[model samples]
Target chain A: MLFSYRIMAIPSKKLAKEDGYTRLKDDFKGYLAGTVFFKNTIIHGYPHIKRIFTLEEGIKRNIKEDGFSVEEKIDGYNVRVAMVGGEVFAFTRAGKIEPYASEKLSFLKEFFKENPGIVVCGEMVGNTPFTPPTDGFDFRFYVFDFMKEKTILPFDEKQKLIKEYNLLQVPFLGKFRKSEEPWKKLREIASFLNKGKSEGMVIKALSGKEAVKYVTPNADIEDIRQNARFVFDMPVGFFNQRVFRSALFLEEFGMDVEEYKKRLGDAFYSSLLEGIKQLKKEGVVREEFRVFVEKEETWNAIYSVLKKSKEIEISDVYKWKEGNRIGVRFSKIYRKTTEKLRRFLSGYAIQD
Target chain B: MLFSYRIMAIPSKKLAKEDGYTRLKDDFKGYLAGTVFFKNTIIHGYPHIKRIFTLEEGIKRNIKEDGFSVEEKIDGYNVRVAMVGGEVFAFTRAGKIEPYASEKLSFLKEFFKENPGIVVCGEMVGNTPFTPPTDGFDFRFYVFDFMKEKTILPFDEKQKLIKEYNLLQVPFLGKFRKSEEPWKKLREIASFLNKGKSEGMVIKALSGKEAVKYVTPNADIEDIRQNARFVFDMPVGFFNQRVFRSALFLEEFGMDVEEYKKRLGDAFYSSLLEGIKQLKKEGVVREEFRVFVEKEETWNAIYSVLKKSKEIEISDVYKWKEGNRIGVRFSKIYRKTTEKLRRFLSGYAIQD
Candidate 1:
């Protein structure tokens, strides 16, 4: 099933060193800079994750749809191996060369002596204190691709060499079909792998050419919203959460409410509210206010009057109180009455 | 007429501290990486007056063509301006913020104050010796691009603003008609700007979107060959010259003849000659025999053969004089061929 693997284009070192919530965002920007746009395997998360309810649900959808194959979530460092002059050297995701295990180094030296020139990609899994017990301290060499000079070796040849050399590989999960219902398949994989204290199943496209894309199994919508709420409820000001919310609000409204407030302060909000009140008294409401806050009961109250008669054009004024101070804003009304209300509100307008 | 410009992409500070040769290579490489190719500038004998040749002349037929226009090469230090927050700060190519140029700081600050949301690209040419110049110091501001939010201002708009602000720009050598006879245009510009002291012109594509391609005003082939021969004629024992010659030879033949001789010894050379004689007596002059040279005449003979051959392949053998006797063996190739050749000949390579 020709599945595209969603590769993380950003260098890992940049991601690891980032502090706070902005790290991911900045890294994402960097990734965008380096990436070629294409649809690929993507791990889905919940509420904040967007377009999905939960990470597990997304995974289940992927699994049910047979969107991808799953790989054992190896809890270890990510490394890339490069072969130069017939010798293989391991590099961390950040491009740092790692000091090889003495035994493994010897093995690798001998392997290169036989293979001559080929770069093999794999994962080094060990029993670190942070990892689960099932994943032992054994270094697993999951040979994904073998590059000779400039050519990539055939998959069959690579697999044969891996077996001949006794190189450990990631356990092969069953193949799944590629389908539009990728989320269903993802959820099933999430459920199946939920036993261990693993992060989640990494859903990689079976197509070997693309870099493996892993869908984190833990991105449940409720889980994400809960996390966001926790961040919001933290003792210190949740500037990240505030920014996140502001972004969400901006997406909904054409104007950046926070930016507007910062630029104009309470005066703008006060003037808007007073204008709405005066308009309401003159029985005129604005249409923009109606669409901006259709869910608010205050808008419905004014709409009720307008629904009955065109002559009594109702003006909707939205009001809210912070402590003892009340702020009000006018809504759009029918044209005839709106002109009359505009004149009445001019009397209360503050001079520039 | 429309003219193109070659903007330095990497910050000058980064380029200044790099190893001289590496800087040269990286300048070429970075130019390529930044979508600029075709190194059209000439590095002349004057350490301070490297000129960009902007004309072309066809040597096959003495047809000269006019090249691009000339702009004042600003004398101040190279500075990169980056927008941080709403304000822009001048940074050295090495990414260090320059403290001296208050005009740039104020210009950027005021621009940011007015625009509030853009990244401005400009050169902060100042009296500071960020790059130690061979000439007198003068400062000039050259505005290039303005990045608003995330969008880079159109090229035309950027040019318009540059003119409006009266910023010093790397002058445009005028545009010429694209022709098969490119060198004709190069020679014309060279002749036009042949002032005894001025750096020559740089011939570039009229679109400026293309990479900077150049021609030297007086780059005679004989002069280059003479320089090469001068280095080669130095005594075999002259380490620097010997290394330089070896490098030149290696570049031509993919094997270091001198180093080979050092490794194998006189006996090897004598035996190789004897072997060739025997092969000639046997009516078998293998192509490999044509490669090995026992005398200066033989070396010259081989050069003609190598020049004519599409692929030059030479056996990896060397003759060296050990004590008073000679011996033959294969030579140890340096890990980094270029560096090894430079080091083996000259006690030191050029520093940054």
Candidate 2:
């Protein structure tokens, strides 16, 4: 039975504005109006789990609380396996399939060729020498669920099927008799397995009901610790590309440019760019382009000015940064030349 | 003291992709790269909230269990009043001030003249009745917080100053002695208050800490319920603008559009547009023009085709429905044609 609540009715005037049905429709329209489809939604999904504690925390909590479970935290790629009809397809955390696994796709295709109705979910984990350390990157299969026709198999049954398929299943952490025990075990696991690049553990419910099926804790801390060394060690251009990609991604997701500025803020953006430039200049990040501050600021200032201007113009200051950080320089000579040129061409200048 | 946690320090590769910080040359550059700025942040912010909620179910829980405190839901336009050196400047929710208020700027000039240190936060609740409410509006000066010398006033002191100023505060709903009591009271209050033209309540913490704040349950429910009615009532064009505004707001908050689609789909949008069109035609909404949906399938199809296209254009068959539920053939064709023509000339032409 669907659980429902009876909501108080709203007045006609106020109701018109807050109508969810209409709001939903507008949302779909907005998406359709944009370029990318199913962009971040399919990858990130809604209600994304923000944090997952490290393995140390899990083990600690388990040890402290007798009721906790201590499962082996596997090192592998997070692959969300889904079944569409009789086919089983594995998607990376971001929903893309690995290009190197094209042969595996055929294997999957052949497997589905016989199993026309069943779908099995599992993680694909394997050992490779050149792979990013098992701490961050290890290929392992963690079978989570399965589906058939319109029915999703129970958690236990899904686990059973993983063994039947000979797929690598994530070691099942024993069930905690008490809820509080898990927290302690989580802490222990975080502390124990934290050494030597082992990222952490993800505590998950055997019966996955909620969208946030798993929790990761010390993983983020580890991530921060590992990356802090490079904080001052990346090239300005390289770093700039990363920043630009994020902005473009935001824009691709249909975010307004103004919103980008508000969220990042002037000071923080300034610092981040400066950090990258410093890293590059210090030979930490190898690059040849001279990292200059004045030129960068001028471009930003111009962009800021043009952002709200009625007319859009390609200012001479606009220069391409590594990827898309359009940098423009403003100087006395350039300023005079621009004014003189503007005055000279005022009659012929076209209004945007 | 700052709360610190040990985490695996893996910095996001996307950090370097931010546009604003990519070109800077200092150590601080790109720090704020992907962060949402006030203006740009909103676009990402709303979507981020959506994403967070989808994962954690926090917002849904908050909406259901944390029955919102019913304050006098302000009827006046949303205004953000800021005091700079004791000079109070009022800005619309979008940050623009009312034109008439510009003439009254001198009234607060003396406050700045007298004490250039105190800054007050207030809202012009019932000042301009440009959009007259069917019911009488009550203007209250509800003060939430304050900022002075770049630092916010202490929470307790801020409340005291608000009281001292004799500014009308959004009334506090009683603090529940028991956790369960608040939810019960919420139902009762919702039933009692939702009958009339009252929009709904704005719940706040009685301790004056902005710990958790939300709109009343009644309002949320009303919004959803009315959405169905609005679809059948309002015009499509007017509805589209409202949707666009909401989208713009979300984009300004740096929200991903996909989240919007997942939460609110095409069917809901079309229904709302149709409802608005109907409302306008029936003289319910006084607006002259109405928002119309070109076709039901057009919205859905756009996603399929334009998922990768940077720019897209599409057109579909549309029909207008009046409040009486009578279908009007091409009632808005001329208006639609003009809008499409204008957009086309502006290089936004995609398809029809």
Candidate 3:
């Protein structure tokens, strides 16, 4: 819970302009500032879910004695989807209206139209700009939580509604008692997911309403490799934690350390080679993001949101029409990373 | 050079106590704060050597067009050895008198007496408490530079003095011009050193007097593996730069990527497993340092110096007699890492 995203208050015009809260003036839905469109209607940001490094220890420490369920923790950006004033809106984990997610969720309009007063806490998975598609698929939303106002609905009711609306939901792993040794099954599931290039599971203590996430080695290793080029751009702990987590996963699950090490090393080599090639050939270090949006306006809206981050510059934007959609490609120029690699490649003596 | 350690000023008693400049009160040689023994007897800290990631561009950018010499870059901690008032003092790179280095250098008494006013800038290599010996030897000093006051003597003079004193000097790799293609030879040298478990070469511009260090892949990789358990205590860049350097080394030297990946992977696996084992068995993360000092006071002096760092806790002291020398073993308990592992192991939900 230390790093949980805090939803912002409805700010004044000046506050919104100053980025105290975000108000995307270019988008009609974001005119009100931040995720707070109306004081009466707000999608509360999801609570931070703690992680478990060791299955047995984590289960003993985090789970309740009984009445606990485990659900598939999808590897995607968290999006809170709901209808506001008859328009469906998808808010990012930070409670800001994400243009890409919001634009793509037009099909969910019917689900909200029928189920009023409820919001769907879902993951925008696949090749979305927000997250690297560890799920390895096209873009789609997978509902993980159904909430009314601030509280999540119980499992049965949420599932019944998902069935009624024919909505995709995270795979329900199952309920278990502490005495049943669920970690055995969970380890198998994590290993299976690791092979499928998917993520891990989240154990929810139903009675206590506390959730904890456990990940597979591939998920952590993939994270490191995916962002290797952005090494200079991100916080230093990003790589360390991933390495630590991979090690923990290997030890706890009784996985073959040699195979995993090769996988990890190969992942590092291939990804880092890309970074080196960029420095050697292009004289820059960055990642290219390709997206297909339903509307040109949608891509523009996403660009506007990204550009406001100030420190990151969106560059090399090119768009091509693919029938009804606009296929666009862009790069988020990590200023610190690009400049750093350029400077180092320039043969400036570095103290190491 | 941006991260170069600044030699501290002679401070007031309060300032000294506040760590403005370290005054190791236990050692007679360290009574003066910082590396400054007296106004006229100070051994200046060596200037930071810049690093080159790419050999070709680095040679073009960092080397002089006319005159430059290449020498073996020793994989050890830098020490400035000088004698003042009949006592030989070995100041570390930051200019603090290293008790262990100073104590071990009694053999250098004659050399200092012979070459008074001229200090030796050398690397304290081998199985010392400082650097993990990539050179793979017992503790020994290899003189790389001879200096009077703050000025490093020219290559010829420094070598002559080293020869006269029968002192070990870093192997000279020969001088070359910009047009003769020195990078080709440097690459071969680096590859050879990589195989021997040594390090790369430092190309010093004789005319410009600027030095840039280029390292072999093994040196960078060894650094990462050696300090894997201390990951939490050190800066995040410690791993990042090493990873970056290894990849660059592969590309620049045209080494086998697949073999390096496996080695790198194995390195991460084995070293990190040690860290995990410590956390699991002892519920803490720490590194053990075993040292053999000729005098018991040397160990006391070293312990006193390390204990003053405040954040680090020296624990589990075990000492025994090895002939005339005292074989002392101690551990530096990394507080942040220990507490973090304990908390994570306790199964408290972590949002990360």
Candidate 4:
């Protein structure tokens, strides 16, 4: 008789006092370190969502025939909200305590107070300092999941509980079966989303954890537009993956390829050209975003935490006192891109 | 007393019996290995030429006021043709013995007979088995340099010798001084080349190796179109470099951005869509090119050598005798790209 043993390389803890994970105590921050001992409980990071370029093939392969809910896949940062010992805390993807969420979302405290020890996972979209503006979503949180202990609650239970708490959530498009030509419906949905300049849709199985996301070509192009100013700072995959997916989306949905191609190309060249103009005229390249906050301390703490993690220089917050809130605008200088563009603009030759 | 001396690391020779280098003995082939020994002499590979995005800054920075000659830069495979022991031999960039050149060009023997041990470096363009077909070239050789021992001969000497041998060379655009608005002239030349659908030009200092090359936007787009089929097999830089250069070319030459944006985007999507269509219909992606040869055995030898170096499967040469010559066609199957595309088409999920 022979036996096989599972051979696994278990990762050891990082050296003590090592820096990387973020922590905050300004409002309600969690104790995030090796093993992330927050309120004497372990909160696992969210699983990475799988993405699909085509709807029919991807849905049939990943989802079941029973039913699936199509929800808007918002373009934003992911954050996990939880109430630990009468305090609300938000954790980022890598178990870092994100203070921005706690300061921005006031309902999180009340929502977590009613549902103790439950983690509300959602996206932080719109006029937040973390990312670019997403139309009308101004520092809003939309609940996408409710995790009890280690497992995510079923769709019905989460919906019931979310409704009871009276919290915001991503808009539910519809429920469809795999046999009902779901791809055709999805193509229509994608077209609508593309027209509105929305991101895409996520297909979630009604009962289980099976889920797959499909994005519109406009979403990919928008991603390129945002990062085009400093494309060199990112890996080539950041742009190529988007372009490749856009092509597949266009082909799969039977959309207008020529129109999308023109827009995609313009998204790349236009943003970068504008960036070049800025650098040539002002000797710098940077991102300027506005954040509206009630308290100046909240913005200051956010700025401090941001500056600690970034290599790029952060500008002092430009505060404009409104009626009751202060609108603060700041910039993150992309110095490397600035220096590189200057060299190229000033006749520095490069080999292709 | 203080003294200083240069320290260098000398590369050791490869162990005997090791494999990687190509060897040929059919006819006029050279002994190629870590050290390229041909006809009782050692021949080194050619150096890479420097490239520039804008002619204005590049010419002023790289080329001095002694005046520079601009020649049409051919988009083709580089080959160093040298006659050794009364045998004409062509070596690729990596010192591989190439028999295709010796078979197609009948005057190589006589040209080498006149100047023994001198390597004439040029490009093989149009209707060839290696690269995509360039218009009007028709498998012709264009001499760009004549090297003696190791150093490249001055422009006047190479031109005189090339003329005496009645060999075809690149069209020599008029020479111009750096201070006499050379950039404006280069823009006109670029526009003309772009209109003709030709690659850009090379500016060579009259007496020195101070040369720089600038390509047209159309050339970059053409490159993308040709390789867009098996783009995954190549580095992402292959596309990004072209796109980046095209943008700079547009900005520097003051071309219409919207027109190029449409074309550039189309170049990437159109060819790839064609490849996808072919793959979905035929289950494979490949490149087919034609080569005109005087003998069947010559085509066979060339095919064999190419197959030995490439991992991609090479198709058997198809021959059709035409009057006094043979027209041969073959294809290289891009199995990796084909397999990857098949997986995506079949709904294999991926994370971006």
Best by TM-score: 4
Clashes of each: 88, 146, 5, 0
Task: Residues B16-67, candidate 2: write the lDDT tens digits.
Answer: 2222211111112212111221221111100001111010122233333332
DockQ of each: 0.00, 0.01, 0.59, 0.49
* Deviation in Å, model 1, residue B74 alpha carbon: 58
Q: Candidate 4 lDDT, tens digit per residue, B29-132?
A: 12223224443555655655678766788778777656888899988888888776676777776667677886666468877776777888889878877876
Lowest summed-lDDT stretch of 10 residues in model 3 chain A? A1-10
By summed lDDT, the worst window of 10 consecutive residues in model 4 chain B runs over B1-10
lDDT of 3 by residue, A211-315 (tens): 788888888888878887777788867888888788877877778899988887787778878887886687667667777888878888899888887557888
Please give the ranking of all candidate structures by lDDT, highest first, separated by commas: 3, 4, 1, 2
lDDT per residue for candidate 2 within A1-352, as digits (tens), equals: 2111112222232211111111111112112111111211111111122221122332333233333333445544444443333434444444343322222333556545655545444444432211232335323445554545324454566666666667655565556544454546544444455333344343334443321112222232233223222332323233222222233223223334343333322222233233333333442221111111234553343345334333222232424565433322321112222232222122121111
Give lDDT tens digits, candidate 1, residues A54-169: 34333443333344455555545555454434444554443333433222333577676776645555565542111222323334455545656434454457668889888876
TM-score of chain B of 1: 0.36
The alpha-carbon lDDT assigned to residue A42 of candidate 2 equals 19
Q: Which stretches of candidate 4 lie over 4 Å from their true place?
A: A1-39, A134-137, A179-181, A309-311, B1-39, B134-137, B179-181, B309-311
Regions of model 3 farther than 4 Å from truth: A1-40, A131-138, A282-286, B1-40, B131-138
By TM-score, how accurate is candidate 3? 0.87
Kindly indicate the candidate among 1 and 3 with the higher lDDT. 3
Docking class of 2: incorrect
TM-score of chain B of 2: 0.41
- Inter-residue clash pairs, candidate 4: none
Which segments of model 2 are wrong by more than 4 Å?
A1-352, B1-72, B83-87, B93-118, B123-142, B149-159, B176-181, B205-211, B216-352
